[model samples]
Target chain A: MDLKDKLVSSFMAFEDGIDVNDPVHDIRSEAIKNFETKGFPSKKEEAWKYTSLNNLQKIDFSVFPKQESALEYKDIKKYFLHEIDTYKIVFVDGIYSSYLSETTHDGVDVCLMSSALTKPMYRQIIELYFNKIAKKEDSLTSLNTAFSKEGAYIYIPKNKAPRKPIQILHLATGNEASLMLQPRNLIIAEENAEVQVIERHQSLTSNEVFTNSVTEIFAAKDARVDYYKLQNDNANASLIDNTYIDQKDNSVVRVHTFSFGGKLTRNNLNYYQNGERIDSTLKGITILDGKQHVDHYTLVHHAQPNCESHQDYKGIYDGSSTGVFNGKILVDKIAQKTDAFQQNNNVLISDKATLNTKPQLEIFADDVKCSHGCTIGQLDEDALFYLQSRGIPKKEAGALLMYAFANNVLESVRIPELKARVNKLIANKLGVRLGFEL
Target chain B: MLKINDLHAGIEGKKILKGINLEVKPGEVHAIMGPNGSGKSTLASVIAGKEEFEIKKGNIELDGEDIEEMAPEERSHNGIFLSFQYPVEIPGVSVTNFIKTAINESRKAQGLEDMPANEMLKKIREKAELLEIDRKFLSRSLNEGFSGGEKKRNEIFQMAMLEPKLAILDETDSGLDIDALRIVANGVNKLRGSDNAIIVITHYQRLLDYIVPDFVHVLHDGKIVKSGGKELALELEEKGYDWVKQETVA
Candidate 1:
């Protein structure tokens, strides 16, 4: 049978240990039916024109890991931002690893979705925001919803802030030869609350693993949220990430994605300004080589007046790798005095590499300000020669030029440690130690 | 210290520097003045080993060694420097860091390790002081938002740090004010030594009053039609290029 058919037939067996009569189970059943009907998106779809999931869907991916696996901290220490203390929610082979996790309930909720979904005390929050903001028609999100029983669930109360940042790490061990994972995350910040989160997905072995993950964020009045996604998976891994954010009045939310290593990655990031004077910022840096592929599809909806959204994405493609970026902005008739700006810049270091960038703006308000700029080209020859003329070799000159090209996006990264880590990664990706201490 | 023999060069199949011959010895300053499109910049670029220009015939030699086959950085390591007219702006790299990298790279080519940190810092401080540049300016991005004067001063600052054997100033006086030009010429004078050579390429005689060339050559239609003492620059300023064009054609 096909992967979708197998998943549908195995749905009942997946619920052997859970309460089948719970209200969340009905939602799961409905989501599975939606997946069965929609199957996988094809290239004919406008949003999927530059990316294709045909090859991924043909492989017979097992819906669940065969068994639970254990990992040592030393083996995967390089994957985490261990330079600073953080509340960690780690999973191994789709099972929560208590040995590797550090949960807390001191002033907020930093726990598992399973506990929040099943326990009686957290039912009110689960009912109000389980899947409220996620688009219902997205089949991949539905696929994640069908199996969203085990992921990170973070809740910050009003007027409170976490002592440190939170890390959500999912490790895929090739115990089942070929595995598929669906990890769901929900983060809600009450009025005047503030939080920072870092998420990453890693595959430990040379086995095929495809993950469909969904995340929903809600920032209430005067709240602040900073989310970072670190994607540097192994060669055999592929990922599709769907993130939806809802912002209220006087709130600020920023999401930064750094994509360096992966066979294929697709990011669907959506932001909705539901209240006046809201601020939304989206930024990303992608450096790919060796036949890797990454696509970023972003959307910003200005529904209220006097809102603002800013987006900037930079990419460097080498070898035969391909990249895509499509930014869409929508301004309603009432969203006057809105300010939205988007910029996408890319460099193809090799002749065989390809990149496609498009900016779509649908503005209804006459008085709003919406501007976008996109550029795809190689490193400036004049700039390269300038550096070389100063005694730097050609290769190092090109590397320095590229590093300078992608430097501005790093300015908005609030966490200093994370910024330093990304700087090192950029240097390493260019295959240079540089003169400074990278 | 530098020799160009019947050199023919061009870019994209269009010949610019046609049948040019010149020589300069150590401690001597040579000035090449020409009208627009007279191939002065092309000649400088070809001497510095810019690959975009094609040398159709002849060759360039430095200190009795043929250098037409070497790359630009190799030529730089051999102590050849060409200060550009319009400097490229690199947004993230600081001026101090850029010069440090350039100095270390040249040293590494000579089978030496990277310069010690303290020594590098001291050298940078001295150079900045010599150019009268502020400490904060050293940390800013290279030439990103610099004024015309600031950019010229930065080029001179880099030249001071590199200390090349053969320095080619390509239009160093193109967009400088009088005060800025005097400061730049003053800095260049301090760096001139009997062990190195300088080639000043300009269109006007304003800069020569400050730096004072040993020999002046007027280029018309890709060839130096006349060579004379420092009075030649004053003659060109007074009589204009029309006089030189009529003399060359006659």
Candidate 2:
């Protein structure tokens, strides 16, 4: 069977393990119906014009794995931000991994979504927040919701901050010939609370692995949240990440995505400013080579006055890699004094590489500042020649120039260790050892 | 130390340097004087192995070896340097790091190990001091947000750090004030020796007064119209390049 039909058929057995009378079950059933009504997105859709899921849908991905897999910490340690200590909520093959995880329950809840869904004390919070901000009409998100049994669940209470950052890790071991996973994560930061999170999806082997993941973040009044998504998987792996964030009054939230590897990856990040003076920042740096492809579709809905949003994304495409960036900003009629800025810049290093970038804006408020800029160009030959003239080889010169092109967006990374790790990855991807630290 | 035998080169289809011939020996300084569009910079770039210009005819030899097919880095490795008239700005790369990489790459090409960190730092300090460059300035991105004078000085600093065998200063004095010009010329004078050669390509003879050349050649229409001693530069500055143009035409 095809992937979609297989998923539709597996929903029946999927519900047998969970409580059938729970309210979330009804939501899950409704989501499956939605996914069944609208299958995978096609090239004909306006948003999916540059990125097609037709080929992915043709692959007969196994919706459920037969057994849980175990992995050693020393083997997959590089995939994590191991330089720093943090609370880790890890999963392997759609099942939670206790041996490889270090969860917390001191002042905040840094644990599993299965616990949050099944436990009695956390049902109220689950009922209020789960799938509330995630788009129900979007077929991919609904599909993830239909199979959202396991993932990270983090919550920080009022006027408190976690002792350290949180890490939500998903590992896909080569337990099956080809595997598919859907992990849903929910994070809530209450009033005046703050937290930082780093999320990554890694495949251990070269086997085919497809992950459809969704995350919903709620930042309450005066709350601060920083979320990071690191997508660097093997060539046989693919990921569709759907993340939604809701910001209340005076809350600050920023999401940084670093996409360096994968055969095919799509990031759909949305932000809704529900209160005044909220701040939302989204930044991404993507470097792809070989036959890799990455698409970033983002939205910022400014519904209240005195709010601000900033979006900056930079990409470097080499070999035959393709990239896309479609950013949309909407300002409601009453959102006066709203400041929203969007900028997407891309550099294509080869003639075979391609990029399609577009900015969409719908403004109804008269008193607001909204600006967007898009640029696509090759590496500056003059700059390369400059470095080459100084005795550096042409290849290393090109890598250095590309590094400078993508270095500005990295300055805003608050985590020093993560930034260093990313720098090393970029250098490795460009196949050069920079003479100096970034 | 350097020889150009009836060299002809150009960019695209248009010829820029036509039948240019010159020779420079060790311990000698040759100044190529010309007006704008007279192909002085083209000769410098050609000698430094800029691929934009095609060498249509003849050859450029360094220490008796033909280098027409060599890449820019290869030419740099063979002890040739060109101080650009308009230096490119590369942000996020500090000056110290850029020079360190350049030096290490050149050393690696020559099959030598990386210079010891202390020795490298000491050399950088000595060269930067020769150019009167601030220590803090060496930490900034290479020429980013720098003034025109600073860019020119940075080029001279690179030349000093590399200590090339044949250094070609292409209009290095164009953007500098008298103070900066004096400092830059002083730096070049300090680096000069009997084993190296200097070719100063400039429009104004004012720079020649600071670093006096042994021979001066008037270039017009892509060819060297006249060759003489250091007095020729002062004469051209007095009579202007129109004198050379008219004399060539006559």
Query: Which candidate leads the pack in DockQ?
Result: 1
lDDT for each residue of candidate 2 in A1-438, tens digit (9 for 90 to 100): 888899999999988888989999989999999999999999899989999887787888888866778789999898899999999998888889999999988989999999999999999999999999999999999999988888999999999888998888888888788889999999999999999999999998998999999999999999999998999999999999999999999999999999999889999999999999999999999999999999999999999999999999999999999999999999999999999999999998889999999999999999999999999998887777678788998988888888888877887788999888888888899989766655
Chain B TM-score against the true chain B, candidate 2: 0.99
lDDT of 1 by residue, B1-250 (tens): 9999999989899988889999999999999998888888888889988889999998899999999989899999999998899899988889988898899889888999999999999988998888888899999999999999899899999999999999999999989999899889998999999999999999999999998999999988888989999999999999999999998879
Q: Residue B75 of model 1: what lDDT?
A: 93
Worst 10 residues of 2 chain A by lDDT: A429-438
Question: Which stretches of model 1 miss by more than 4 angstroms?
Answer: none
Q: Estimate, for each residue in B1-250, the C-alpha lDDT of model 2 and write its tens digit.
A: 8999999999998998999999999989999999999999999989988888999899999999999989999999999998999888887778998999899999989999888899999999999999999999999989899998899999999999998999999999998999999999999999899999999999999999999999999889899999999999999988999998999889
Per-model C-alpha lDDT, please?
0.91, 0.92
lDDT of 2 at A425: 89
Q: Looking only at chain A, give the TM-score of model 1 against the true structure.
A: 0.98
Superposed Cα deviation of residue A407, candidate 2 (Å): 1.1
Q: How far out, in Å, is residue A18 in model 2?
A: 1.4
